[model samples]
Target: MRQIRRLLLLISAVWAAAPLWAEGERAGDFDYYVLSLSWSPTWCALEGDARHSPQCDASEDFGWVLHGLWPQDEDGGYPSYCRTPKRDPSRAETAAMADIMGTDGAAWYQWKKHGRCSGLSAGTYLGAARLAYGAVKRPEVFRKLPREVTLPASVVEQAFLKANPKMTPDMITVTCKAGRIQEARICLTRKLELRDCGAGVDRDCTLEDALLEPIR
Candidate 1:
């Protein structure tokens, strides 16, 4: 009886230690999507400039760019890196997303990590990503800034709400990283309609004054 109990305990421990997005999780099993929009200038200021990324070039004029459309579980844990039968996107396919994603590599990575979990083919997933990106109206006020500035992170969220009247505070989250405004993540249904973010996706940055770099 002691040996049997020990074996049962071992099995329970293994189950508890397993990650949320295990390798074999079924695709298209998530409840909603989190559309991440990264602020290009902040990325450049944080890491892109050091690497001399092309998106950081003055001529690029990139402001808010699609980071990824992620599948999320309503509870808190989310799926990632799920197995999919779809073939990987080709160079041309990924490159086409560079205009809005900042780089082809970013597009490819997003497909590998998140898109695969959507249970859609690479082409279809990329197309859905584009549609989701276009659905959000990026605020033009930030684009017109002539120089860097510091402001409350909530102000960023408010800007998005004001620009998108359909979006409520629960549907959007502003995040800060390394003292800079990083990204604005908005929740959406599978059909690309605005929706409230899940519990795990509702974390908003609490920075009183976060630095925002002007578009380069």
Candidate 2:
């Protein structure tokens, strides 16, 4: 009994330290992403000019999400710079920013947005805790500066593209953005639809689409 108790305690500690997205298959009907993990103030910046508005004003703070599993490389995918415990070799700039902004005593969790309950099987992480950076107002200098940030959708698309670069743009990209943004008036964009499950399928017939749509 003492040994069993010790094992349970150890398991609890590890589970508490790990992100919820660390395990499980995120089907479109139900999926999850990490909103931010160890995000730092210096990490705040616009990733790129918005696709529609290159010069438009925006700022983004980036972090990691283990899409299908923990230590993503083990899933037979090329590892992302942020997924590994160590610094990313390719994105020196992002690595630096993440480090500077990484010291906050923030805990990470995968928010489950109940899919079937909401007419969408897909669930996403909604950050319930606030970090210093999350709630603080940025100074003017910080406000307008271009920061490197990547949306979960961008990461998802990139992974697919890396695997099949020759695949048509329409064939590979999954468009997802944060359900919640900073604006009080702006409601979250409802259920993101992922296109391109495979060949010859109707673009709108994806599981995400079906799940996201209200029951008729």
Candidate 3:
């Protein structure tokens, strides 16, 4: 009886803290967004021409593209599939997201997976995503980067801070894979300004020097 009671209390506590976990709430009622910017070259090297999309095209310079603007909680956990859209985005909608994100598949996936939980319409969510991405100021290192650059993930963090005065290291994280940086996650407030991502969102790279591969 004591164990059962404790478990019940724990469940109640989690339920009470809906905002922290992005659960038990309507869409758009949660915390800020994590504007995930993918290092396009990493994707190209990993997936190659097999995926065969505009984003993976060699002719286009997709250095760092908007992966998705995800709704994140105070904790690392985020909400998803809170609601389902009755229909898909129109052609115009897909086109609108092309430059900011990639293709219809990318836009629609973000819409269905993350945007739906945002409590905003597809248009509003995507528009906000684009706006949030546009607000970010890129670092010079990424623009004029060598074909293969290596530095600690924190080095990348410092570069961003130097470039954007309003930004702090706490507001962003670098995601790496196979000793290479896959993405740089920069968090923002609802107003699209730099904000600290809490402890839940952490730098998970175990590498000493994270490689930023070229956009070949």
Candidate 4:
């Protein structure tokens, strides 16, 4: 009994002294990215019945693009989650295949709309991307996005202004770029500018299809 107790104590000390395995050792490490584009009149001209229609135009604070990948550190090993773009099509799916290809596309679209009206914050976009990639890649690198995102603000501004420059505006584009991982970008176009920090102005509205881009 004494020998057994001594062995047990020795084992406990060794176990306690040993390093604790980190949960994110391979799951938390990851890189993220963002890319943005402006709406072109040619693209915006697309209407109902068109193969791919612009759901929202720059004037209405639209025209944003985002793409991402959870690449591995090893060369030529594309992200294990790359398949996310083709499978489940729903967040509920546990398989990486369904996540990368299916639900991610819808999630991107939702983020675009939500971001436009402030319903979705920048964190929302990053969170969705991370969640999607995590479901598949399980990267170990830190996945938090930078304070500023890398979006094509200039392009959005040019488009919105070309449509109506007389109106004051507040526009911003954010891009999130992480080495190795695919980039993700978002653009926000605002026509109404606050003359005063805490004031509002009259703005007109028209009902149009919530077209951002062709559902692809």
Report the number of the highest-TM-score candidate.
1
The Cα RMSD in angstroms, rounded to one decimal, for candidate 3 relative to the true structure is 8.5
Q: Deviation in angstroms for 111 in model 3?
A: 0.6
lDDT of 1 by residue, 1-216 (tens): 999999999999998997544375678899988999999988998899999989898889999999999988999777788887778899999999999999999999999889999999999999999999998999999999998899999999999999999999999999999999999999999888998988978989999989998888
RMSD of 1: 6.5
Q: Considering TM-score, where higher is better, how would the candidates rank from best to worst?
A: 1, 3, 4, 2
lDDT ranking from best candidate downward: 1, 3, 4, 2
True-vs-predicted CA distance for residue 152, candidate 2, Å: 20
Structure candidate 3, residue pairs in collision: 28-118
When 1 and 2 are scored with TM-score, the better candidate is 1
Better of 1 and 2 by lDDT: 1
Clashes of each: 0, 11, 1, 35
Worst lDDT 10-window in candidate 2: 180-189
What lDDT does each candidate get?
0.92, 0.26, 0.77, 0.29
Query: By the lDDT metric, which is better: model 1 or model 4?
Result: 1
Cα lDDT for residue 22, candidate 4: 25
Q: In candidate 2, residue 2 scores what lDDT?
A: 100
- Per-residue accuracy of model 2 over 45-153 as CA lDDT, tens digit each: 2222333221122343333211121111212232121221221122333232232233111111111222111222111211212221243222232233354333333
